[model samples]
Target: MNFRARGVFTLILGSFFVSGIAGLVYQVVWTRYLALFLGHTSYAVIAVLAAFMGGLALGNAWLGAKADRVTRPLLFYAGLELGISAFAAIFPAYYDLVHQAFLAVVRGLQPTGILRLSLQFIFAGLTILVPTVLMGATLPALTRFVTRSLAELRGKVAALYAINSSGAVLGVVLAEWWWIPSLGLHLTLFIGAALSFAVGLVALILSRRVEALGDGVAPATVTSEPAEQFTPRQLRLAVVAIGVSGFVAMLYEVAWTRLLALALGSSTHAYSLMLATFISGIAVGGWLVYRWKRQAHTLAAFAVAELVLAFTLFVSLWFYDLLPWWFVKLAALLARSDPAYFLYEWLQAAVCFGVMFVPAVCLGTTLPLVSRV
Candidate 1:
């Protein structure tokens, strides 16, 4: 690669690393922190995490709509990174205050369990809303930075996603093996904040260089042949369908671990395994979709994938109770012998991976197709 290409690749890679660390911190640390402070009965932590993720989706939609209008997409993304870092720095204090406020309200009203849970959800949502939204804005913003053509757009987006997901997998492993034990919860947040800020600075600097070289201008619009023309409704439908598919795939992966844990009567470790498998599946799926470029039909593929996912969920639910005891016992024995927790965990992961594969592949195919339209 040339100098400019190398710089852009480095920027994307750094952003992926930062994103991975941030995701890992939230997944492994935040929930435990909340549980410790609010008692194990608090489902508020999960609620907060969910709200954060939802906020990210909203941010992506909002930022993407205006991506073409933004003169300095890198600056906007950097500002978001800084903002998220600042929040991470003060999250402990903010969370404690919110927890106390919740308790005081509960004491005054003597609310039922459901009411308390509602309050917890609200508190969690409030704490994570801004940062999560900001984090969500980065992907589309970065997409604009990296892509120059419709065909390149799909491959670039897929590559970036694979890089980011790989970072997340590493982050999860690091959090469990190093961050939580060595740095503790608060320090882990600070470490993630530092990484985010560093990545933002690098991206901003590289963007400035591109602008100075006159390489930042929008690519000239190509005249479409009559056969290539698409109605606005079709264009909008395609974009919306792809976005929805992406969101659904993410949500299902998020919830799959808990569902598996309930089925196996085991610890959350099984769920963690499922998450790892799902992310890996997405990375692999993106690669395969890119390789099978000519065979991809973005919308049709997405619908079929969604249907398959639904079927898988139904099968898992239906068969869970009827699973033979010997099979479960043998699986557990294999899991115990495997140092990486491969066997039992992989089984759970396989189910989650099956649910994730189709939608991810479909969504991966959509980016280039939609950009072309």
Candidate 2:
């Protein structure tokens, strides 16, 4: 990449990092807020998570296909960011109105659990789908924008993933430790919206500047090959691998969270820490792939990483099985003394980190490797 292109790519990645933070902040705040109205149940968690992931999948499949067709990708990207901000700005009021209405009607009817759960899903889906979908389109749009050629694409994508995941880590930490606690939900929402809006403004300005430089043609179409370049077998394998990995990773995340709850207390603090540690592994893995630039060995590396991840996770299950015993021993030693809570929390954190960190890192590394392939 030329110096100017590199500079623009850097800016794009930085913008994405900020946007990632905004996205996670929205997830943390909105989920908690909705739970207040819907009541805390496994159904509520499933509804929220489904809405978030479903929106992303929709955006990725729909908008991603269109990203490469846009003449000014940054303009498109900026518009998407603005859309997310607009939704974020309005969502609080919308959700409150919807939740209250639903609660009143459901209370009058005294609905069954399934009916109530379905209603929660519908409300959560409606409240979050627009912004979350817009957030999802960002990866494909920004990836298409930053890398002008196929050769540079993988590295740029990996780097962007790294920075974005790092931003998520920061967001989770801040939301738990500072933002939600200090700013409260409305102000926190506005803050995230502002960051996203600022990113959109910056992208709009850059789009115009690039246009002024006479290289403003549809960037995404420039010398890019279609997926048909890969053989049918390879394409099928890729699809299968992606699906398997996603399913496995998500299942593992839920299992690990439950296990960690036994070690740590099942507070928001513990949940936030768990997410941060898991995502940090992904960020580190992406950064490693970007820095190493070893695409030739990506397939082998990915396979090895997957094996390592699977093995480590299985081993960690055994550790979890023994964790309660270990916790009791440690607790007895502490014996409700001063700093007992602090030390216990620290111990929980350490145990959680030790068990998941390596497998999560391996999980993270495999993603970029697969993307590279």
Candidate 3:
């Protein structure tokens, strides 16, 4: 299940890695599109993110059930990817209709203040949830295909997560730095859709030949609904604790991105760098967790990881205020030209990574580490 070596498992790993890349590409594309539609205010940004996250949560809860029961989870995953591709293919038309609906609702209701914001959130959520639900459902299917029982769940899930996150890092970089800059949005979307379709098609082909190895599934955890009742109080507490950690992790992401944007520029590219740096740390942390999965006293390891995560959060805060100082120094050095812009862009991304990387890693480690406990 490690899929570290060359073989069918390696192919599966690569497939999921590509899937992760496609998923993040869609996220970058969708977030940029929705931001343009809703306006780039703080509340608007949160609305877009909330909608995206909400849809994924819904998918994991609902479609995830199907993922659990399906004998060929690979096929289910293929179907989900194809569904996302289909949505992406039609998203341009749908994007236009959503704007029309937004305008119509505004004209009819003539709402103001909180009502206006609520309307924005509602429209933003509806606009994003369509494909994101399908996007959200992918991991559950992959997870079901990967492992069978609680015993095999720990390392395999952690490694798979790391692989997916690694792909996400590449996706963010490519979407923001390379694809959108060179190809433009609509074309970039076509590329994203194509990647999703390719992954699904490959998965479909693989599903026919390889059978799942695991017997029972302890599915990979994401931020979704509450877990079923645990007979043991300790188990219940651990589950709740991890849930809280995930909540706090999201708060950190939202807060950090909002703050970093002030220093990094609120351009679409800057947002992508912030996301990439964050996920990069997560990917590294997941890899670390996979490596250390067999440590004795798993609970202690989880607690220690949490403490490190908290400490890094404070560390990031200190670094956050220093970002402006670094930016100001660089501003004096650079000119308002293409080469300067290029230099400045990567410089700011580096600063973002420096501040965010460690904390995000700790945060990422906690999720899979908890499963070991």
Write one digit per residue (lDDT tens) for candidate 2, span 44-89: 4455677888898889889877888887777889999999999889
* Model 1 Cα lDDT, one tens digit per residue, 247-297: 766566555544555544333344445556665666665555546444245
What lDDT does candidate 1 reach at residue 30? 67
User: After superposing candidate 3, which stretches have Cα over 4 Å from the reference?
Assistant: 1-6, 41-44, 211-231, 335-338
Model 3, residue 303: C-alpha shift (Å) = 1.2
Whole-model alpha-carbon lDDT for candidate 1: 0.63
Q: Over the full model, what C-alpha lDDT does candidate 3 score relative to the true structure?
A: 0.80
- Overall lDDT per candidate, in order of appearance: 0.63, 0.77, 0.80
Question: What are the TM-scores, per candidate, against the unseen true structure?
Answer: 0.80, 0.90, 0.90
TM-score of model 3 vs. true structure: 0.90
Model 2: runs farther than 4 Å from truth? Answer: 41-44, 104-109, 211-230, 331-345
Q: Which regions in candidate 1 have their CA more than 4 angstroms from the true location?
A: 1-3, 37-45, 64-67, 148-152, 217-229, 243-247, 263-268, 314-318, 322-328, 331-373
Query: Which structure is stronger by TM-score: 1 or 3?
Result: 3
RMSD of each: 4.2, 3.5, 5.0
Question: Could you give candidate 3's per-residue lDDT for residues 188-281 as a string of tens digits?
Answer: 8898899989989988887766645433233334324333223477677788988898788778878977888878767777777888999999
lDDT score, candidate 1, position 335: 34
